[model samples]
Target: MIEHQLIVSILLIVAICLLLMVSHRIKVAYPVMLVLGGIALSFVPGMPRLRIHPDVIFLVFLPPILYEAAAANSWKELWHWRRIIGSFAFIVVFITALVVGYIANTFIPGFSVALGFLIGGIVSPPDAVSAAAIMKFVKVPRRVSAILEGESLFNDASSLIIVKFALIAIGTGQFVWHQAAASFVWMVIGGAGVGVLLSYVIIKLYKWLPMDENIDTMFSIISPYLMYICAETVEASGVLSVVSGGLYFSYRRILIIGFSSRLRAENVWNFLIFLLNGLAFLFIGLDLPEIMAGLKADGVNLWTATAYGLLITGALVIIRMGAAFSAVFVTRFMSKFITVADSRSQGMAGPLVLGWTGMRGVVSLAAALAIPLYIPGTQTPFPERSMMLYITFVVITLTLVFQGLTLPVLLKWVKFPNYDDHLPPEETERIIRIGMAQASLDFLQRNNKCADVKRSALLNSLVTHWNEQLESEGLATLYDDELRKNYHNILNEQRLWLNKLNNENERVDEEIVRHFIHRIDLEEECLLKE
Candidate 1:
């Protein structure tokens, strides 16, 4: 059995890699491709039905993914769009859940309001992974991306909290509004508090401890899990904990770690997220057969569940569009009374794009799967579990595939308003490069007394380079083939010299030599890219 499981895992990995390659070649979103591939694979005769544990998704896959996403976002941008993000994440999600609940309760026979909310919460939050993957294939404004990213981060917490309360109301056969509301507030505040506290400790540990870059990277890998588990232990929102801690750590990364650690951590996190996200969407496809089978066994009509799914999905999109346009108006109104980054009432393109980008993925599935198999302390099955699962799966598939594919076409169709106030990307990069060059020159000049003749010559060369960078309008383009060739040759020679030194010297550590080689490689890469 174990060997069979191992073979299946290996095959799934191979399949995901192939699907991703195909997605890239064909210009389709990888998540969409992966899901379609997983579905195709599931129908093969004798293929094992894999059931994903909710704990595995929540504990193993979630923390790092959320942390990475949160950390990648610019806190400055998130803050500037806080109002929009807050409305979408909290108000929009709540309203959508209520709408879904109302629809489910009204349409589905014997489906209680609490059960309606259970499914609502399950499907409320749009998956950042899905939206981000789709966005990669389309060109959208930076602000739209920021708002979506920020909304995804917070909405997960809010939606899950709704799930929690709904579950409580179901299990105990009671719904206390005041207690649930108070508990929600505590969970959010407490979760954020836990995250902040853990981040402080982790930051201090990085600063005060004697550790290498590998160890620094390891701490980063562990920090999210620590924050998540700690917060969840207190019955708080683990999502909030990871996000808050991630944001805090991201803001303080330059102070906490060296360049090597940052580079290594970035690469490691990127690969980790890719693998996890790929497997997640693929699993959703794989679970389809089982979900359908459950629905059949429970005597539920497939068409009925699908119709409900479609209805809920349509309602979600409409609600999101309404909320988005309303947010623009609200922002304009609020700007009149208070300071805002941009007060202009932008056109419908931004709101329309934002509205259309709501795609559900792993988080919704995990929440649905997390539902208890039976009512608490009873043999009775949870109300409409199979139906809800089917509906959630339907929503995920339709939104991820339909919206994901259509988004690029929509972007091309909509005429986005251009902002003259903000600097162009190239101009921003140039200004930043100039500032960095000037700072480097100032630092070297201030420390000139510490350099010997050999070091001073190197400093002089660096000084000239920095001056050139400052004067250049853009990145220093490597237009001269001879200079590029000479740079490559020098790098190779340096590597050979380092190898010779390593072979001859017993005092110098091998790791230190490898570090220098890595630095040379980085330099060569930068030069070639220039």
Candidate 2:
């Protein structure tokens, strides 16, 4: 059975990968196709059913997913908009839970108020993969993208902290709002504090050893799961540990680490994330049978579950739209603090759209499964455990399908920027080049090699070549006597025209690309001759 299961797992994974590739070619989200395939395979006669425990699901998947998203985000970019990120990640999540919870209680008749809080907790954080993957089809501002990525990372912490309050309501049959608020403060404080301290201590310890990129990379691969589990075991939010640890690494450890080490870490984390995400969607597919079976055992028939799914899904949708629009209104007040973000031309649209695109998938499903089978201090099972799982699965499927497919169109119609202007690749590249040149010149001067005229000429020419390449690529270029005497003014003017053309409300990628190449090629040919 083990051997057969391994074969099926390998083959199914392979088939899904292939489907993902095809979906990429067709411009649809890969998760959408994978889910459809999983559903189809579930009803197949004589197929071995996949029965995965939810605890195992999170343990196996979440660490890698969060790690990859964190690693891929440009730390520099994220820092520039840290204010906006904090707003959405911490502030917005708290507001969302209250808003979503209120609507769920007021509108979804027969649903427990505690469960409404649970619903709020589940839907509070936006799915990073779902939002970004779908964004490929639309044009959002750069600041918006960074904010989305940052908020998604931290919101997991907020959502899980709130989940504790709801869990207390379910398990202990007692709840206090003031205590819940106090617990949230502790959860955030404890989790972030512990994570930072642990990560800092780990850095100090790890630095004493020789730099073996592979071993360090391996450490990166496992850190999230370890930190999260440890934090959760001690009664702090595990998701908080994951995010805080990730941020700790991003801000301190990753920056100080060497490029080779960073690359090694990134590669390992990427594979880990890919496997985790793949398994997550696959499990989402596999969980259908189990959830359905549980619902049947609990007297919630499939048809009734479907109806509940639609009703709750509809309510959540309306709630998100209202919430997101409200977020836009609040942005005006936020604008007094953040001018770029306040501008309608930047990432405000992202939050507005992302506000409505709150698609609950793994986090909610995992939380549902994490519900204790035997209620603590009770003889009975956790109340309505099977029904909760059923509702979670249905809600996840509806949100992933409905929002995942349609958000791109909505964003495009709203005319978001395909690339964020504030990212300023040109400016960033220029700074890097200046630093490198300063280092190179200092090295030459220290070695007393500047007297070698042929060598100096060649070195200068090579640096010039590199600078011209930078200029051609729309990056920053350092000023030089030769460049100022010959090439700088003309090239700078052309760059100005290109920027003008871009901000002039143009669309279509091919033409802008061709224009860049035309300018670059002209510069490249000149360098070859020089």
Candidate 3:
């Protein structure tokens, strides 16, 4: 068994790496193909079943996966569509819970209305792994990209809140509305509050310790799971705590750690996240047998449950498409009072992307596995457990296979290669100036730090030599004060213009983005040609 597990792990890495190459060559999402392969392999005999406990599940997978997803998102991108994120993370989740629960209650009886809501909650948030993977295949507009990425990054907390409440209602036989509401509030607030405190505390400690690259790397490995476990113990949402802590620490990389330490930490965490992501999808593939067994034992056939899943999937698609497409419609009504928001001018998110792109992966599978074994039990397993699993698997399979495969085709049809939404020129200018300023003061800063005039002179001379070399290479554009002032003024005008343009014709900004995209393409072409 141990050897088999080892071989499987080895095979998974090699298989995924090979698949990664193939996917790039083919220009399609690997997840679709991977699941297809899994489904085929699952039909073979003699595979060992893996046992997974819910608590162990999150600790093993969630933190690293969430960290990787969050770390990949620039803080700039996240803040861009803050409103869209709020809608999905806060409002849409609640609505989905209400609607899905209402539907679940109608179809499946002996299930309490509140219990149905718990099921709704389980299905609410989009899976980060799925979104992160599939987003690469789709050519969404910049603002839309920001919303999808940001919502996926933050919605784990909301999804978990629903799951937590559902588990409490089912396991402990206690369900309190005010308590659950308060629980949600406390999880967010407490997680953020503690995360901020811990980040600074870690920073302060680093000052006293013999901070080194290895130390930071080790700390990175430990911190996310530590925060997660601590929050879980307090009945707070561990996902929020882990994400908050990872973000707080990552954003403070420069201030709290040396350059060498930061790099070491970053590399180690990246490797860890890769492993977690691989294991997550692999398990999703391997766990098909369990779902099958559950179905067979319940005497529910796939054809029957699948019929229901098809309709349910349609419901999911309708809701999500209706939500994504009508985003502007909803935002406009709220825009009257809210006063500010991100808008796609055609009121379209581009590329005829009218339908909900539901790419279900491990999270849905994990949630299904975490399905309660005893529902407030007289020891009777949750009724129709097998049927529910079958339905969920069908949803995951259809989405991963269909949406995952066709998304690229849709992009090609719509010319959906988004280059719209140029990076703020002023922001770029500011960054350039700051970098130039740092280069200019390099030697002087070294002298002040080490207090060695002779060494400092050599360093300063070296810095000057380096700057001159870079200037020759066309890298340093001069750090003059006059240039800075003019650049700042131009930036201010650009911002004003941008605001006016956004206010008037939203679609025009798409042109601005396309311009940048074309420029980027040209630069890339030149580089490759060289």
Give the best candidate by TM-score: 1
After superposing candidate 2, which stretches have Cα over 4 Å from the reference? 75-84, 99-110, 137-139, 253-255, 334-352, 417-435, 446-530
- Candidate 3 residues lying further than 4 Å off, grouped into runs, are 108-112, 137-140, 171-174, 343-346, 350-355, 415-530
Expressed as tens digits, the lDDT of each residue in 1-530 for candidate 2 is 79998998898888678868877898887676666677777888876777777678667777667766765555555666676677767777777677767766786555577767776776666677777777777666665666678778887777777777887887766788788877787787777777777777767757777767787887777777777787877777777777777777765552345445555565666676677777677677767887787778878777866776676667667766676566666767777776644446344555567666677667777777777778778888666667667767777788888888887767766655454343255554444344434444444455564554243444456446544543323333433454432333333334333433333422322133334524443453354345
Query: Which residues of candidate 1, in runs, are more than 4 Å off?
Result: 448-455, 468-521, 524-530
The lDDT per prediction is 0.81, 0.65, 0.62
Q: TM-scores of the models, in the given order?
A: 0.88, 0.80, 0.79
Q: Candidate 1, residue 135: CA error in Å?
A: 1.6
**Tens digit of per-residue lDDT, candidate 3, span 66-132:** 7666655545555556777788777777777778778777876455676667666766666556555
Residue clash pairs of candidate 3: 420-513, 421-513
Cα RMSDs of all predictions?
9.0, 8.0, 8.2
By lDDT, the candidates rank as 1, 2, 3
